[model samples]
Target chain A: MLKKHNILVVEDELELAKSTLAYLTENGFSPFHAKDLKSARKLLKQENFSAVLLDLGLPDGDGMALIKEIKNAKNEIGLIIVSAKDALDKKIEGLELGADDYLTKPYFFPELNARLKSVIRRLNLEVNQEIILNEITLLPEQMRTLIHGEELELTAKEFGLLLYFVSNQNRVISKTTLGEFMSSNYADYGFTDDMVYTHIKNLKKKLSGSGCDDYIKNVYGVGYKFTVA
Target chain B: MKLLTKTSLNFISASVLFFLVGSMAMYFSVRNIMAEDLRNRLLQQQNEFIYTAQQNKVMDLVSELVFVQTTQNKQLYSFSDTVLITNEKYMLYRKLDFSYAQNEQDYKVSILLSQSESDKLIMKIAIMNIGFAMLFFLIMFFVNRHSIKSALGVFYSTIRKLEDFEVTQSSTLSLDTAEIEEVKKLNQVFEKMSAQIRKDFISQKEYTENVSHELQTPLAIISSKADELMQADNLSKEQMEQLALLLETTNRLSKINQALIFLTKIDNRFYTEGSTFSLNDLIKEKLSLFKDAIQDKNIKLKLDLLDITHVYMNPYLAETLIINLIKNAIFHNKSGGVLRITLSNNTLSIANSGGSLSFSEKDIFKRFTRSSENKKSLGIGLSIVQRICDLYSFNIAYSYADEHQFKINFKK
Candidate 1:
């Protein structure tokens, strides 16, 4: 069994901080909450966390400074900065200072989950992937995707998107979320929902053309759901 | 007021003085020249009179009698014991009326001359003085008027431009060529100053945008990692929910920052013009991009696009304006609401069904001004739209017709 990772969330807003703590616990991760840099630093000194989710604005000091201190301490902890300051310079500064990811406010919970998984994967979190679901064998690490014991050739975008859908199986994924996952430069690329339509269209066509039962179902006026039917 | 009045008074006084002095000098010189000529003629007349009387041989005693006579009236007097021989007396006698007749080269010369000629001489001197005074007055009037007209024109125009100047409107009151060199120089200075101010304004706007852009990546990392952490296994339900909310807030914060930075860029005029593109085509393309969002929100979009060819504008700015307008309509509108987008003759209008905006008509174009009711908005959307309109010289107007309506009239 893979040991669950621990995360430290530093946020000033009490309600928001509490909600984040709740969400982390429900998702099977232990989270330490801190309302300021001082408490966050104390938490850091006391226990080792797999990653730190730092908010840029803190009541005591800047969260950026905390990110720097963590990086400087030579701790192999992954950092993710949560800030209302979504300016390009702040983003670059946070990332340049060893933060693994950045997230803005008012984001969808599911998207946040997707981003969290990506970062964890980047950190090489140990997890068993050989799972048998009926006739399908899923091996996430080998990047081998199959249906009915036959390999399906999929584009890079298709593969990433499919994998994301598989991870969040049986849940409705919004097109906006799909676009975000498919695009590296989401803001600049103008990846609108139409682009999502085209990609999804291609993915569906390819899967069906490969003589595989279509698991991708469009939930009209919403998004798509990947499930074993 | 005092300074101007004094200077003008001095100028008038100096002109009057110059005229007076000049007329007086001319009058005196003319009088002296006339006196000398008259005296010389009278002396000659007196000598002729004596020579004629002597040659004709009147009584020797009588002929020898020296007489002094006034030339002005021809009154004679006998010098009982002395001869009248002084030039000064001859000059003084010429001042009186006198007459003399003599034959010179067969032409009888009758001369009646005085120190002052006829009354016409006085009138001529008066006329000459008056003419000179008038000439001086005209010169002064023209010079002063020219100086005043040029000065006041420049001053008033400068004030008008200052009053009417819009930051978006390039300074139209150019000092490139002025009638007065000094005014031209001043305008040049003003032009340089205004240019510098404009440059600084643009630079600061760009700096804000660039700074925001620089901040985006780190924010992405932080928010993404937080999100990832929220999804890991074996955590309490409360902790999981808390991480989830953190991730959501982070995402919204990141968007607001991005919007702010982009707004700054638009405000600073940091845009590039690409190839001429069809407004209709661009709008269609943008609408397609929002297809998912529109569908997801159940918003019905109706696009009334004209088959126009192209518009010469910064494509990026145009796109931004359109995107913001559409996005605003989408975000503020109720689910299943109607969104109408019309593009005709380069004019684009977007109307959407939504709650009444809490802002006044005036504040709609201002930056960071969200409706009082909606705190979640970054408030930079319409401001960005306004900026793009300004850059392209397009006309933008907003109206509230049960729903929010924004219209942009593009200029070629």
Candidate 2:
């Protein structure tokens, strides 16, 4: 049995925090919730968290105040700033204060999941060198993939889409979610439904042609799902 | 006209008018007084001549200035002007004529006085008056000009400060104190206005950020809830499709909101920090981000970098400007259409082989003016592009002949 990594979600809104906590728990993390900066600080002192999803606007104070404290206490802890203020200066400031990543609000859960996993994997490089799903093995550190112990050729974008799906398996990802993922991850402005479809088609073809089981499935003409079973 | 110039002109014109009128009045008054004195002396000399004639013979009283002549009838005393030629020079005289009887003989006596002496005195007085009055006016002209210039010192400084004032900056407008009441009042009004504007600007900025936070947090909640619902099993196809639609609409609304905030920030001149970089490298870098989309659409990209043009701009805005333009060209292009980009002589031209706009060409850059068929486009990309260009005063033009083209001139 694998040990569940502890995740801390610092958000002021109760409903948002509830949904995020539920999502994190379902994704195999031991999630804890804090509605304000004081409670978040108390929670941090009580538990050793593997990652933190910080909301910048807190009731008592700015979430930026806690960034330095959290970073100085531990370097291995993965911190991501989840802010509604998408200003460039704010993003730069958060990153400069040792935040592992920055995610604007109204983010897709799948995107968040992928980024959180990537941040953890990066922090614990030796422990998580590869992601193995049956015959398919993914070396995320090198952007390398193999099926039946043989190397698979994939483009950078194709690899990113596959990693996103693998990180969030057994759940339906809407076309809009996939489009936004492509747009935000690649910093591309105009990502259309057709582009996402084309990229997914190519990635699925490459995966199946390599004598690998078809894990990715199309769902109800609206979205795609990567079914592990 | 400048205030100083206008005031100085008025002062000069008034002094000239008053000086002219005063000199004329002084000259006439002096001449009148001299004429009256000459008349009074003439009367006194007539008395003297009559007394002398009574004592001696009337003919003996006749001298160089006095003349006696026998007359048939007695003439009442009268004064008249007479001209006499002496030493070949014309001389004007005021003469008094009277009739007298001496020892039963009737005689006419004439007494003459030269008027040239009083005329010379009047001229001297008139000249002296003009000289003194001119000196006084000249001194007053300089003093008036200097006083006005000094008083308006604070006013000119106020104008200069206004010219340099930028609402985006955080500094408050502070004006110098003035001795002049009108200028002091003007400065007070200006300072009050600037402070109000700053307050409004700050509140507006806060409002924009607040709106983003207020709307985005709810959107996040909705999206997260819908995503959570998607994990449920035993759901019908219709329910799943509806959930997908809900999530997509929520995402769309969030995007529109964020884009609007970005547009407002640009309008408010929020991005001010800048650096110089090469356009060629930036284009290549941004194009790589859209390579997959270009490949997916099978658009043939033609790049002609004739020069390594460098531009000084906010790097983030520069990136956005190029990305938005290229994305528009590629996104709007037909399948297998040619996307041509050429840069030279501080100009960039991006052309795409796409069908003509369904709407008016003039409306192409307007926000939310997309074709009915292409609902995926946010329609704010071109507007953002135009705004960034407008910020830097770059000339941007859109045209369509055989293909849709966007041209930008970096230099004005």
Candidate 3:
């Protein structure tokens, strides 16, 4: 079994923290909630968390200031900023400041969860560079992906996308986030979700044709998820 | 007419009227003065000559007599009158006749006094008067024009500043170059107005950000709680239905808020970064993303991608426009329908097989206005697409000819 990740949520609102904790706990991860930066700092000292869900607005101070301290204290922690709507500049700034990913506020917890996994996966701080799920095996260094012991022919982009999904499996990844990962430049093109969908389709078609069972799941009006269903 | 032209024309007309009145006064007064002086000098000379003639009646017999004429009895007084002295010159002179008793005999003496010198002097005065009036007119005209130009410069500078005003630039108007008091006052008013607009604009942007930030907490809580409720086991049928309705309502509210915020950001000119990329690749990628939906619906996709089209735009907005268009087509289409996308040159056209829309093409781009076929739509997708097209000045045309068609023509 894969190790269940520990998630720390730093939010000023009690209800939001509760929901975040509840969602994370339901997903089989240990969750710690902090209502302010002070508590978050204290929590960071007392325990280790796999990821931190940061909110920019806090009761005591700006949440952006805590990111530097969090990074300084723990380099392995995956930072995901959940901020207010239309604060795209701040989100980019957060990403530049070494936050793994960001989402605007009023976001679904599932989105937060997916992004947390994606960020952690992309960070690749672990020793296991090889990921195998079911009959699919992904060699990250070689940029090669195989299904059912047969080499699957994938374009460079398709290969990268497959590896991304293999690394962050069982999470509902939105087309927007997926597009950002695949092209590394289409995040600004809000319409690229269709492109992400197309790539996922091609990847799935190639995988299933090679005697691999269907593993990619679609969530209508949402996004796609890779799981051994 | 321009301010400068209008004022300059007025000055020209006023100067013309002034020259007309001034020339008449100057000509008459100068002529009168010159004529009076010449007449007085002629009359004094006549008196002196008469005195000399009276002193010696034989002066007429002497060679010094100006004119010596004897007439019987024609009583005509000496008077000065204007006469044509030459072809080009006129002269004023007095012709005199007096009785001179030469050796006690009755005789009529006539004396003619020529005033050619005075006539020349009067002609010079007239020329001087006309020359002075013309010189004054030209000087005043040029001075007035220069002053008007400077005054108009103030307004021109104001116009230039107004042209430079841009909300996205976030710079205030500086019309301190205006000089005229009234014009300066107008510039000051505009400066204050623009400053207020900039302030209001910034505050409005910040307010949206703050308000949306505050809204997210509650929205997150409600959605999360709804998701939790959805997973609850052993729920009654009615309760489950009610929970689903609640979740739907919450989701709808979130979508509306999100769309509103996005529209506000676009209007505020927030997305500034852009780059060039292969639009063909982006479109192909998006089509793949929608493959499953296409398969489930069994819709046939006809692609006529002729060339590798390049688009320079904010990638985020570009992607959004593509997805929204494709999604809208997919959402509104019937099962086993056709979706045709033709890309030729800078034109991209998307058409899908669907029932006739109840809404007119004009009203389709409006937010929250959905077709009768799709109740689940947020209806802001087309609005966002419209806005994106509008921002880039790309033409978007829609039609319903067998299939709902949307065509976008991008600049080459």
Strongest candidate by lDDT: 2
Candidate 1 per-residue lDDT over residues A1-229, each given as its tens digit:
4577788889877766766777677566789998898999899899888888888877787788888798787446878877655455678898998898997654444555566666666665535545345544455566666767888777665666666766666555555456556544233233455667877888889777866667888754345777676
**Cα TM-score per model:** 0.49, 0.88, 0.72
Error of 3 at B394 (Å): 5.5
DockQ in order:
0.08, 0.74, 0.28
Candidate 2, residue B294: how far the Cα is off, in Å: 3.0
Report the lDDT tens digits of candidate 1 across residue range B254-345. 66677777766665555553578888888888777676567767899888986584777777677777788888888788889999998787
Ten-residue region with minimum lDDT total, candidate 2 chain B: B48-57
> What are the per-residue Cα lDDT tens digits for candidate 2 across B199-280?
9999999999999999999999999999889878887899999999999999999989999999999988899999999999
TM-score of 2: 0.88
Maximum-DockQ candidate = 2
Better of 1 and 2 by TM-score: 2
What CAPRI grade goes to candidate 1? Answer: incorrect
Alpha-carbon shift of residue B60 in model 3 (angstroms): 6.6
Runs in model 3 deviating more than 4 A are A1-4, A109-229, B1-12, B41-123, B130-163, B169-192, B236-245, B272-355, B389-412
The candidates, ranked best first by TM-score, are: 2, 3, 1
